[model samples]
Target: MFILPAALAFYRALRVYPSPVELMMIYQKTVPEPIFKIVIELTNLDVKDRVEGYYNKFPPQSLGVKVETRMVGDISKKALVLTKDVQVGEVIYKEFPIVGALDSDLQPKGLYCTQCLREVEPSMSIKSPESPVYEAVYCSQACQSLAKPQHHNLLFTLERPLPPQIPLDEITPEKLEARRKAHTQFADYLKNQAYGHSAPLLVARFIARQVASEMNKLIPGSSGIPSSQDYAGADDEEYLLADHIERLRYVEITPPQEELKLITAVLDTVLPGLDSLVTEERYSTLLGKMAYNAFGVYYDGARDDKPAPTARPEDIERTRTPMGTSRQIGSAVYTVSSYLAHSCDPNARPSFNAGNSQLHLIANRDLKAGEELTVAYVDVAQRQDESVEECRRRRRMELARGWKFACPCERCEREGTTVGSEDEENIGDESRVEKNMQRFESNEGPL
Candidate 1:
């Protein structure tokens, strides 16, 4: 390991003239380990550990970039800021993760590789005869193998009869009961949180898998996943779910009983003679968490030869199932990407790569060290005139209704003056609203 004196001097030289060569020189002189391995360790450590390690190794002034938590008004905002200037179009980070949800209604069956969420060539897809859900779709043998664990637990076909269809005008008691029963069974199976029937269930499974993976690392020669009987007693198993779900943004209002009842009915229907596998409270929490955190999965470009759909263009917006494209094929929660805070004017942008099931975060402009990276939760570029008040109104509506936080961003502070310090207001300027009818557009910034 490098000593403090060596590290400090190396850091100072790099600060004065930062380059790949300088970095390599410092590493060669001080680090006995492979430089690439050290770089990977630095990049992949837990955010807190990474920040602390960097600060300890070199003065904060020496590192040109850092990810830090800072107080913004009463809230703590986690931002990825530059310690040095970075050029526009530079990729800040990249992640490849399986999507939690894909709209089967929009995408043709077998369009995506199950494991990586990458698009599959129809001719290259593998088929499963035994499974109903995944019976005829997979991008490759490798993806199928990679997805086997999650699939085995969550993707079994139920040996049950489908309820007979009844015409809408001739509704009957028997039909209603059958429909209810079918839905209940679906809910029960869904509660297992296996392959992400819903975003929340998928998120739950993601959390569980991560916990199990970590546990395996700590305990050798044994599966890290504890049996249900041992789950409660296991260390931090429950907290993993609690912590991740809590990160979702939601309004502080209580869910209605009707919704709760609907969820309870489904749990009851799953496995008739057995006890319900999911509790109503847990189900409710999953629903709440999903409401705020799920990301739309879409083909990055047009999916076919058809003319663009009537909806807004993809280049300027995040549209699910955009006009000519396959649109949103599904939804996902990229755990790390969720940390980015919303900004009307942002310094970073997220672009999906359908080919590899990856999310790429690109610099929107030349960013100075210490400038926080941000992305607009809603379309910031869609608004033509850039009326400050219109932006405030739209942001307030989204925050109050969905995000459950009062934004104190510079733009919000500027336009929210007459609307009261804390309360959000509706934007009544129809003409201004009409100018920016699209949602989630990213064209306005310096990308």
Candidate 2:
């Protein structure tokens, strides 16, 4: 188990808070001391056991790959290293997402399974008429059953939020109305305002999943709602979902205040005090992580008729996809696949061969054991009409604009000399991890 440093204990006793500069994006004004104190307490509780030897716990042999730390200059990066030699087109592993969300445009249309994002024939799909605010349809009974217990009931339905073993206050008519109103408001907010962004819904689903996991522990002989357990190891018993999420890298994001309020309101209404699980700082970090790590789920060759975005270029949401976000039907975040770094010429590519959110890692070239697996985050293939130099610039610009990172992969390095100065000014890496995560990884104290 990871241990907290002595310095962090001292800081906790002193009640030291993060500086304004560190919180500017998340908070417009000074956070009330009480809320800030809650943030500090939550951080102290979680950071103690998140990072040290965390990657070692994943079952590498079963997954056919291991996560190893590599140094790119002074920065420590995690990479997926193959455990066995494989040829092109070989399947390395298959993973289910911890949480998945359909694209905003498709969510209300009932053309896809909200649980798996699988395309559904209207006549054959199962619809949830009980959902007051969201129109959730499933392709199968299994999808509907898994989704309701995991998150759908808590967020979208009036069903009991906790297991029978757990006691609850009487559900008065007033309480029921309040819960319905909160769910309706949050669902309407997502439908009317979320647009291209799937991060908000993904974050909500993740939080609900965590709550469900904890609640399930109250009953005997229950493993809780299955949450991407395809390769979980013995250490999973000791680690919570929060432990897995806190270690991943995140880009900074400033979500709207109303979004948080709507989500927290729903949680608080369902189970009192559950809203405390997500503070402003925590919510922002969760959103950033989801946005950074989520993969676009597409099938076949991907679609070409996605609607053009009216949002400004910088405001448009982008998921990690070689096919580009426009072509994807939905987005999902996988625990293991999150470690697969980007390459202009990748050794492995993520494929949704099952026509759902499940990810299959396919080898692009013959490889030896210990080779680092990589995938193209943005479309990196040279277009038929574009020159090599032009292709390099286009991919680099997408990386910079979408992920805030300049490519330093072997392919980019070889072509760097040919790219001229005209595009150099526009490309740069501005990506960053959360401050607490950096401190934890570096064996320092909490902020």
Write down the TM-score for model 1. Answer: 0.55
> Mind giving the per-residue lDDT tens digits that candidate 2 earns over 181-232?
9999988888875446889999998888777765665455655556534634
Candidate 2, TM-score vs. the true structure? 0.84
lDDT of 1 at 2: 38
lDDT of each: 0.44, 0.77
- Structural RMSD, model 2: 6.9
User: Which runs of model 1 end up more than 4 angstroms from their true locations?
Assistant: 1-67, 81-85, 133-136, 155-201, 207-278, 302-327, 354-356, 383-392, 414-447
**Looking at candidate 1, what is the lDDT of residue 272?**
29
Candidate 2 local accuracy as lDDT?
Answer: 0.77
Clashes of each: 15, 0
Q: Which sections of candidate 2 miss by over 4 Å?
A: 1-53, 193-195, 227-236, 418-447
Q: Which candidate is the best by lDDT?
A: 2
Clashes of 2: 0
